[model samples]
Target: MKTISIIPVIRVLSWIVFLGLCIKAGAVLFTFTISLYNPPYAADLYQGLDLSILYSASRLDYIFLMAFAIILSSMQAFIFYFVVSIFEKLNLVRPFSEEIFLLISKISYFSLATGGIGLLAHQFADQLVKNGLVIGKAIDFWEGRDAFLFMGGVVLVIAQIFRRGIDLQVEHDLTV
Candidate 1:
């Protein structure tokens, strides 16, 4: 029986953490988008929902979204460290050594950064629009950011899967 190394265990755990973070970030963005569509009041007199309740719910939703972003960013950084550690243990794909992991980490960081920025921008733009201010471009920009964040989360997940595949391949080769 062959003993599994601590390194591989850590690598798998890191990927799991990364996957969780991505899911969380995605959920936050999705919730924010939904909140935008569900306004407090509608002229159609059928569903008698309380305006104050709806407003409070949306406010709470926004707060949760912001918190999710912060948590995801912290998890991303931890994942980055774990990725580098895994690479070192496997001694594979060291063309640029830690530099490659660093670059990937930067990409993750940027995605989270832009996502947070977009959320804040959207909030303010929404306020301006509610105030009867003419601000078309701000809304457009916020939408763009949301799109960027969603895409970024997807790309990161793909990358993590690819890396896991490589690890499995290495394990197979060692066994054979």
Candidate 2:
């Protein structure tokens, strides 16, 4: 398939991912808000994921947990937004532009931030579990922390390449 044919497919997939993350973040926020007032709702926040034990143990912990979920999902969605933008700005014949470089760099930073936060949140969950909170499936939120970190590094390198590509393109245009 031509590269042009694939760009739209990838862009659509990115949009789907972005929308999914946004929905997830919204669901978590909604569940958290409801659980705060209803209490029993905490037993099954956002589809059968229970945090009631942690809720009963400490409201602060519960809030922090939900905040982590919201923040991570939102950050991932934000990263995908940049991904879509990158695809939108992409030109197969002239791929490197300052805007694309900035967008890629932004994605790298956001990915790194998401990974770091995920690691911290995972550690926090482990501590809670050790302390007898039993976060259960909630701890799975950061399961992709390592992957995000790796992607961040890779994207950072790509951003640097794009920067050089931009320089080269400018030089070529001047020579022509």
**Best-fitting candidate, scored by TM-score:** 2
lDDT winner? 2
Give RMSD (Å) of candidate 1 vs. truth: 12.2
The lDDT of each candidate is 0.52, 0.90
| Deviation from native of the Cα of residue 31 in model 2, angstroms | 0.8
Q: Ten consecutive residues with minimal summed lDDT in candidate 2?
A: 1-10
The RMSD (Cα, Å) of candidate 2 is 1.6
Candidate 2 lDDT over 32-92, as tens digits, reads 8999999999999886889898999999999998899889888998999999898888888
TM-score of 1: 0.37
For candidate 2, the lDDT comes to 0.90
Candidate 1 lDDT, 31-135, residue by residue in tens: 445544764331111122122332344555334434444344444545455465545555554332334444454566666666777677677656745755443
Per-prediction TM-score = 0.37, 0.95
Give every collision pair in model 2: none
